[model samples]
Target chain A: MEKTVVIPTDFSIASLNIVKSYVSMQPANARLNIILLHGLHQSDSIRSLLFYSKHRMMEELCSKEFKEACYVLKNKFASQIKTMKSDLFSGFTQSAFNQYTEANNIAEVCLPVLYNPKFKNKNSFDLLPYIKASKLPVEMVGSEVDVPMPEKGKVAELFFNRVSVS
Target chain B: MKMRIQIKTTLILLTAFLSIILMFSGFVYLSVSNYSYEDFYKLLEIRAVTTAKVELDQEGGSQEMIALRNEFFEKLPQEKDRYYRISPGESFKNEAEELGVPISFFNEIVKEGKSEYTKNSMFYKGIRYKSKQGEYVVIASAQNYFELHHSAYLRRTLVFAIIAAFAFSALIALYFSRYVFRPLRKITDRVKEISSENLHLRLDNNSNNDEMSDLIGTFNNMLDRIETSFETQNNFVSNASHELRTPLTAIIGEADVTLSKIRTTDEYIETIKVILDEAETLDRKTKALLFLAQTGFNGKTQKFDKLRIDQLLWDVKETIEKINTNSRIHIDMSLLPENPVKLKIKGNEQLLHLALSNIISNACKYSNNNVVNVSIGASDQNVFIIVKDHGIGIPEKELKYIYDPFFRASNTLKYEGYGIGLPLTRNIIRIHNGEILVSSIVSQGTTVQINLPVGKFEE
Candidate 1:
């Protein structure tokens, strides 16, 4: 049986480091299916909700650099990784998360220990709280290799600078 | 034989509108039907639970409580109630048959709290009520008369509305199409009134920046081009005839004067020389005119071959040297591409030779035998040829008309030319898909730049 792993991502290149660390700990002969999940709020308009499409979301969400990075990772782990695909989790409720996990047959949730999810667009939100509250076993992978994260909004940067200087 | 655009547009609009109205009506009917079904089922379920509470919970089926329940709620059409006493582990197969429902309905009500079934506009709501007396299955069945009659009315109304909407939309579509296409019809009528005789007539271009105005602007631009080219053609014909007639008149006059009386051999020889010179000029003019006409067509009379542009330039230089020995022309090949394939282009060698030779010879003629520098260069997409002459350049005001056949600059009257060379060269270059740009300053020089697409190498 293939062990499918779900990793919540912000679509940055650094997010893949958690996936890399998780894969490194797995058995060499184990077959793996990697699902990179992103939290995207569905359109509130009835017309858009009626005609919702995930393929369109993927095109709008995935950047060129992010796709290239995923391609490189897939190739680098071709021996153990059977398939790699991205999916959107649009629900905000815990039951919805449970349904998503059940639908995808997710065995476990892997996340970075000290990671803050980045919203690529206005419709995106933090999915970590839902994942944390779910019944699935959550494994926290340490970002000990020090992946460079992009800076957030100016307010957070100002707060950080003041605190560090003081 | 063909339908008019206005009719087609109206039909298209009507079809789109009808489809939208039909879809909207269908959606409304489906939702209303769904709402009636759910509402009837909920009402039946409430009645079943209330009756179960009264009969099972009250001591011995109280008549007063039933009367009170009846007084508060309106009676549903053909309402009936059934209660079955439950025995542990006893299959309800017989009860299912008696109730005219599948056994799954009983099993669902037993497992889940309640279940509903529908058959022929009749709704059945079954509930499992556990009271102090015992566990009982109470099912309330009713005919949804309101739903049955209201749906029939709704269906009739929807069909009538759809038909009425179709007719109304068709009328609106016709009017809208007429309003939209009125200007187009006017433009068409105006266009029909214009002919080659009245090429200057243009449609009125209003100030609106809509599609109609764009079309009018485009049509007006087309008319401008037609009028300009027509004028050029007329000018070319008259100029060519005059240029041809001048030499013919000279030859005829000289011959007539010479033959008027007998004269000495030297005098006869002098007369023949003058006639020969005139005939030679006429021959040159006729040949140049013929070549100009031939090159005017786009690759009609010529066969294109992939030839190296540098080699073609060299051939043209050799031909020019042979024609005018005193004409000093230099070919600069310093900018040649390392890949020789970049230097290749698809062109007719003969026409190309004619074109390049014309430019060089003119340079020699106009510059009074000054050295002309011809350089060749290539980029990834195109090859460029630059020909420079340190000659008495064309006047600034006359540069635009230099390509007109038999149009010569004022200062070029001393130079022997019928003004056919530049126009012929331009035609040849155009047929080869090359651009020619001539920039000149009087008494200094003229530079002609020719840019042609580089030929791709096929496997």
Candidate 2:
């Protein structure tokens, strides 16, 4: 059976690296489904722009970035790749992720550890405790290096061995 | 040697402020120090993980790892970060072992997967990482030089701040003490200027209504009492001298006239009689004065016995009747309690008799009719004696002064009195812990009520 995996992103390059590192580490015979979850954190300016023409505003804000990420993910992985967006302007990201994972039959979650020098004492995201408290298996990928393109074979073997044991 | 009230209060306030400031500063210092330690430990943990990633990875050789290590070293050169790689089976030869951290501490880190602690002011964080290479324990440590320097600087600044604060507090306290006691100083100066000649001088009390004003008011009230007492003493001395000299002069004149010429037996007898009358008047006045003096003294040595108040009044009536056969003094026992104990009172019997006789005799002498009625009654706590007379009562205004020695009512000038009776009677009653109340209307009547505490019965 093909297993669906969820990756929550903040549209940062660090988050994209985590997905790339995780996907490249899968085995050859492993059948997997990948979901890229984006939570929309709309500012007042974006909200006003959306209020005028939501369809056009969304296309203008997300078209280029989303397309490039999708193209990269598709080219890197043989598994099915899907994209999802949630209106997180009203609620917490953890709740939105939980709801998306449940609806999409997500078997596991992958997150990135991104270091912020400005906030060395604070967490980059407040989602780990929520994910740990949930009934889902979770993995963390380190984003210390800025690798534009990672070796697919190396990442694939690494992730395949790690996920297979658990 | 003795601190003024303002100084004392200012010192107390300053002490309280300093105490609060010290507590708050201590809490702040502790919190900042704790946060600094936490941040240091986090940095050490990150360094440990990054070192493991760069050094232990098989795919990334020494070249890339060396470059990464250089980048890490260049970024945080001031950190003075150190690392010790220990193999579990080895003899534990490392710089960390040399740093004197117990070998058991590293063992605990390996067992628990990770541990962080501070030893000798140096933060130590150890992590056990397993890679394809081998099982390795990475112990990272650094002297928190930045935190230590920051704390030291904070300590120096706090010391200076505390000293400055104390000096400022002393200055403020001096100013506050002076400001608060300004009114008291004025009052003291004014009081010091006043002597016997300026007894009429008073403190200025028209200031803001506060405790200081209350103090000034109390002082002025005390001065008023003292001045009144002084005037009364002066008046008493003058009046007593005049009263004593009058009878003495009359007796001297009679004796001189009798001796100036030889007289017949009848004439001599008449002169002798005149002298005797003046002598008797002088003797009575002297005796009354002596008794008044005794009662005015502290009654600690006075003998007290429980005596029935009703029986004492009857004795007074009998004595007055014997002195003057025409005096009609009646003792009314209608309100007397059936229980004889209720009428009992603690007093010096002789003094009580003298007091009652004075009131009864005065009533008989001043009444239109020579009739004085004395009633005896009792309450739960006291015995009451009411002496009522249809006399030429004192004037309303003069009633207050009736208890003043030698103070006579305007209407009573026609009556023969040295004006010592009421004051003497009042003193006698007060020594026995009793109150005497007199109410009268001119040409109508006068009533004197004496209330004395009921005596406790002894077994």
Candidate 3:
């Protein structure tokens, strides 16, 4: 059975450790779906609301470093993780948060204990309070190791130079 | 040229400030002068209408009314009044000449009831009044002394302010231009001090993140490349001369010794063989040096075509077979991606062939006829070629100099090579935007890995 786990992300290199923490708790060779959730305030004006697009928001929120970090995580956990996707959460109330989790088919919520997301945009908000208020079971994972900020050099080392002599 | 930049900046600022200042001063002067002219005309018109009311309406003018008018109204400077009565269809030609007024002035009053005109500093007005008497024309003339004085004062003040503003703006523009160009001045002086002997010196970039700092950074990076190439060229020239001399010296010494003493036929044959061996070494070194120099240029004068790396590898193996008949070489292609397009790379085929052949043949030659395994593989972005040789490997200390021209491993003294092959191959690979890495354990083997970016197929 495939289980979907929702992990909060700030699109930072450090936030990717949540995936590592969650994957460590799963059974060996168990297929799982991972959702990286970022919280943002939705446009309230009528015109903007009518023209809202999730893909454009993802492009703005997911930076080059964040995208590479996601690729590295997915590749490293390809066997146990079936799919990893990014999602935007724009809810202000606890009831809306409950609906979003159910709609995404999230079976469990994994929150980082040490990580506080640094919002990249002005409209970004912290989703921890809404997730805590929801009625779903939440697992607080500790991710203490701080990944060094991935520069161009670090990203190249991860993407290329993975030569295995087999 | 440098001073012209500063002067140009100053001129631009001055022109902008001057235009704005001139416009403002001109507006003030024009408005004040217009108000003074209108005020003086209104004073004359009011006087003319009042004279008509007091003189014509009073019928020869009551003594008490005249006295009251004289007491209430202060006389203007050079004020004069004239009254004339004329019937319908009559022109005041004689009266106008006598009063120094044009005939049009009187005609205008008769037609419009009132009119005002000015000549020099004198103001005039005429009003037509009718009662029991025939139509009457009352003319009022005055010299507007107060208005003339006010206008003169305004003109003087405006000219003074404009002169002062011109000087102030010139000073400010000059100072601002100097402040903006101080950094540029320092940069020029520092640049003037640098020469080929001081290529290691770099401009300081301590300022904030701005265009000036960006320029300095770019300049320093350029210097870095220049210094590296200069050192390489200097090293190549010195090493080439020394390597060439060693072979010629050996051949010359053998020839000289053979000619100095007569010997047996066998001895003469041995001497000739030694001389011939040294000559052959000289010939090989010259050809290798020539090839190295020819391939030193990047991409220019070379034709690049889309080449399948696997096919190129096969061609290299075949070429090595023609050169070294006893060489043992095996190619492993299992690691290659299923898509043949991944193996395609845009490169000069001859250069690639030379580069790959150099490595493969060296591997077979160094390993003493042992099997050399060559593997071809590809990832999404790059194609990989790995050549493994079981031979007396390079010393760890000397591995760094392998890319230097005329640099050879200390353990490979017995092998016949001029040490130009590896550097030439590296240059060819770099032209293709590829990287080569060598790792080895002394006395065990050496593994060489080359990666080239994949090419796009033509549409």
* TM-score for each of the candidates: 0.46, 0.52, 0.59
lDDT of 2 at B164: 85
lDDT of 3: 0.76
TM-score of 2: 0.52
Candidate 2 lDDT, B1-459, residue by residue in tens? 988688788888789768876887788788888888888788888888777777675574767776867866535323444444556566554554676777776777768988887766777788888777777777677778656688999878787887788788878877887888888789889999989888889988788899988998898877865665555455556545644665687778778888899889999899888778768766766665555444443556677888988788877787667456689877765445556776788887777877888888889989944677777666556566777777888888888999766789999877878777677677678778788878777876777877787888964
Docking class of 1: incorrect
What proportion of true contacts does candidate 2 retain? Answer: 0.00
Point out where model 2 deviates above 4 Å: A1-166, B1-13, B16-20, B58-77, B80-128, B135-296
Q: What lDDT does candidate 2 reach at residue A109?
A: 81
List each candidate's DockQ score.
0.01, 0.00, 0.06
Worst 10 residues of 1 chain B by lDDT: B291-300
Q: Give the per-residue lDDT digits (tens) of candidate 3, residues B179-202.
A: 999989998899889898988788
Off by over 4 Å in 3: A1-166, B1-3, B59-74, B88-91, B205-221, B238-302, B307-340, B348-453
What are the candidates' C-alpha RMSDs? 24.0, 42.3, 10.3
Model 3 pairs whose backbones collide: none
Model 1 regions lying over 4 Å from their true place: A1-166, B34-64, B76-296, B305-346, B379-381, B395-398, B406-418, B454-459
Q: For residues A1-166, what per-residue lDDT tens digits would candidate 3 score against the true structure?
A: 6989888887765566667667767887688899989889997999998989999989988876467556545545667788999999888888888899998889988887675567869999888788777867888776354432112222222222221111
Provide the lDDT at A116 for model 2.
30
Kindly report which residue pairs in candidate 1 clash with one another: none
Q: Write the per-residue lDDT of candidate 1 for residues B228-305, one digit (tens) a residue.
A: 556546556754674477568777887899889998999999988878876876776666556545444545566678
Candidate structures ordered by lDDT, highest first: 1, 3, 2
> In model 2 chain B, where is the ten-residue run with the lowest total lDDT?
B74-83
